[model samples]
Target: MFDLIIRNGKLYDGTENPWTRLDIGIVSGKIANIGDLGHEQARIEIDAQGLAVAPGFIDTHVHSDLLCTKPEIHKIKVLQGVTTELLGQDGISVAPVSELTKPLWQKQLKGLNGDIGEWPWHSIDEYLKFLDKSNLAGNVVYLVPHGNIRTLVMGFAGRKATRNEMQQMRELVEEGMRQGAVGVSSGLIYPPNVFADKEELIEICKGAAKYDGCFVVHIRNESHRSLEALDEVIDVARQSGVCLHVSHFKVAGQINRDKYEKALAKMDAGRAEGIEITFDQYPYTAGSTVFHAILPPWMHSGGTSEMLERLKDPVIRQKVKEDFQSNLDYENWVLNCGWENIIIASVSTEKNKRLEGKNVLQLAEIKGVEPADAAFDLLLEENAGVTMVVHWGNEQDVIYGMKHPLQIVSSDGIFGGKPHPRLYGTYPRVLGRFVREKKALTLEQAIRKMSGAPAQLLRLKDRGFLREGYWADIVVFDPDTVLDRSTYEDPLQEPAGIHYVLVNGELTVKDGEYLGTTAGQVIRRKT
Candidate 1:
């Protein structure tokens, strides 16, 4: 007998094809059949009348590295119909830390990944095994973080790696791929990663390429220098022969808005030149990340503790302000988008929690200090654990990226107090705003970006399609009413219209509520 049967639903099948009226049968955690299924009998049956049944969404970028261990609190992903998440993004994550560097990463990543007290694993294999033991809400995949590999070989050093050190980092990358990482990820604007030269990146990409793994990167700059940064990564892809996926691709700042078409053309040209290129972006103009990322890369050279110490030094603070005024080489968020456009999103301490949603300008007034000093003090007070949402681009630009044939959807969501609405709203917002309202993408095309496209990019074998003989990871939602309710101010709200979700043929969400079933598995790259 079939384990379950979903009836009377229109299936999109994740192939960018037209939806067809069909029923699906699931058995032993796999899709057994897809057709009329009227004569099928099952242990359980779901009447999905008037619902769109498709492959469960795969979030291509997420910071759920530490949060995945707590399935109860991590249900936000599944509630939005995400059945699998690609973690270890932005080149910094929990695993592959040495006893010495563990504390450093813990401190550095607290704002982005959260402080989960003590981490249990220190290697890629151990971390994956830990996820296997945890009660995960959805399937999890990983990319070997470039920062972790670099810190393992050299502890957050600001200088370029020596040849021997580069070899060591490459070896670590190979070890991670052998242990099942599907790719390698780096956040070039973030420190340690920022210190890496292009040659180092090419070497690292070669390691991932050896395993047929993709190279996912948050490029060095997303504003005025965006074109150059794009060229740099494209060159890395050309040299290493790795598939390249840019994370949260955008041309930020009003000054650089004109570069949007140019950036897309650059990507097109790269693809035409035989370099595989794809990108994932949240359907929003505002970008979110740790607030400390605003500082010049040199200040973050010694790690979080040392950076925090430097923040207290008047000389160093003056130097930082000077760089903010003079430096056009780095991302320099505060310079591109004014301090008023950068709003604090999260903080660790109770005293600073009140500052969560306030911009640095408001924070300056409240603290009776200059905007720069107010931000600097907050970073010190929070021990460098501060996150922010920077209003960086326009809605039209977001739509432009969405319509690109090579683009896929990803939340790029980071969670904490006053998190970006994208964390809770990304998938539904696309279905509602972009598809239903704006007409930027059709319903079928949207589903393909969120589902099949990401799955293909990550090389997931069987989870991204509603096909017979595939795993039964599915989402059933009301197309007419599907919409995201979360907003920047009230970011904790869940989405509407997602009624049923299944992971590995097990029902995890029923009637728009989580069923508390931990049916997720750790999906490792096939070596």
Candidate 2:
């Protein structure tokens, strides 16, 4: 007998094709059938009348690596219909680190992933195994982060890799890929990773390419040099012959709003030359990151401890202030340092909980200091790591970019205290706010962007579509009722209208309630 049968649901294939009613049969953790199974007996049945059924959402970018270690995060994410989450995004994760460098990597990344307890330093496979033991509700796939690999081979010493060091970095990539990394990801704007020269990246990509893996990057800069960063990414793909995926692709500063056309032209040019390139973007205009990252990358060198020490020196602080002014527009400064834009999204330091919803600007004013100075002081007081929501991107740019066929939507999601609303709201906002409500895209097109498009881009073998013999990772929702309720001011609210979510033929969320089951697995590259 089949394990379950979801009958009478309007199946959306996440393609341009029209929707149709179908009955899905599941057994042995795989799809047993997708057509009429009128006589088929099953242990359980769900009559999804008047509901829309599609493949579970695949989040192309997520910082849920640490959250996957907690059982409750699955309650939030699985109920939102995400079946697969890509971890180690934006060049930060815990894998591939040796015992000595482990603490530094964990502390540096805590802003995004949240602080974790002491863990052993092991291979990439062991890290994945640890996550599996946590029993979260969604399948997870990770990119072997280049930053961690760099720290593993070379300490936080700010220098280019020598020939021997490059080989060691390469061997690490090869080993991680063999241990089941989906690909390699790097953040050129983030330190240590910012230390990576072109030769180092090319070498790492070469190793990842050997496994037919793709490289995803958060380009070096999103300001005046955004186009140049685009070109650099394209060149990496061309030279290494590995597929490239750009993360949170956007032009941040006001001056760069008009530069996206040029960015598009660059990607098109590369594609014309047979280079493989694609990109993902969040739906909002405000970008989120650790407040310390906004400092001059040089000041952040040698890791958080070094940075905190430097913050105490007046000379060093003066130099960093000058660097910030030079990087930002003095005449028309569009910074998010104040309370209007700088909300404390998450604070691992227990004493700072009161700052959670307040903007940094408001906090700065109360302290009778400049926002920049307040930002500097807070970082040091918080151990040089505090997450901030920066109002950076242009709304016009965000809307225009989402309309592109090549631009898939992602959350850049984090499950933390007063977190960015994108974690809970991105998918529904794309469907309810963007497509149905705003008319930015039709229903079919939005589904394609969220489901089949990303799955095809990552070349996930059988997921992201509604078909026979595919894994039964699916979501059932009411199209008219679906909407994201989370807002910038109150970021902790859940979304509305999603009724059920299944991972590998088991329901993690059923009838709008979390079932507390952890059927999720680690999906590895099939070599």
Candidate No. with top lDDT = 1
User: For residue 103, what is the lDDT in candidate 1?
Assistant: 92
Say which candidate scores most in TM-score. 1
Q: Write the per-residue lDDT of candidate 1 for residues 333-422, one digit (tens) a residue.
A: 988999999999999999988998999999999999999999999998888889999999899899999999999999999989999999
The Cα RMSD in angstroms, rounded to one decimal, for candidate 1 relative to the true structure is 0.8
lDDT of each: 0.93, 0.81
Worst 10 residues of 1 by lDDT: 65-74
lDDT score at residue 337, model 1, on the 0-100 scale: 93
Model 2, C-alpha of 39: deviation from truth (Å)? 3.6
Error of 1 at 66 (Å): 1.0
Instruction: Give the Å error, residue 509, model 2.
Output: 1.3
Question: Which ranges of candidate 2 are over 4 A from the true structure?
Answer: 328-340
How do the predictions measure up, each by TM-score?
A: 0.99, 0.96
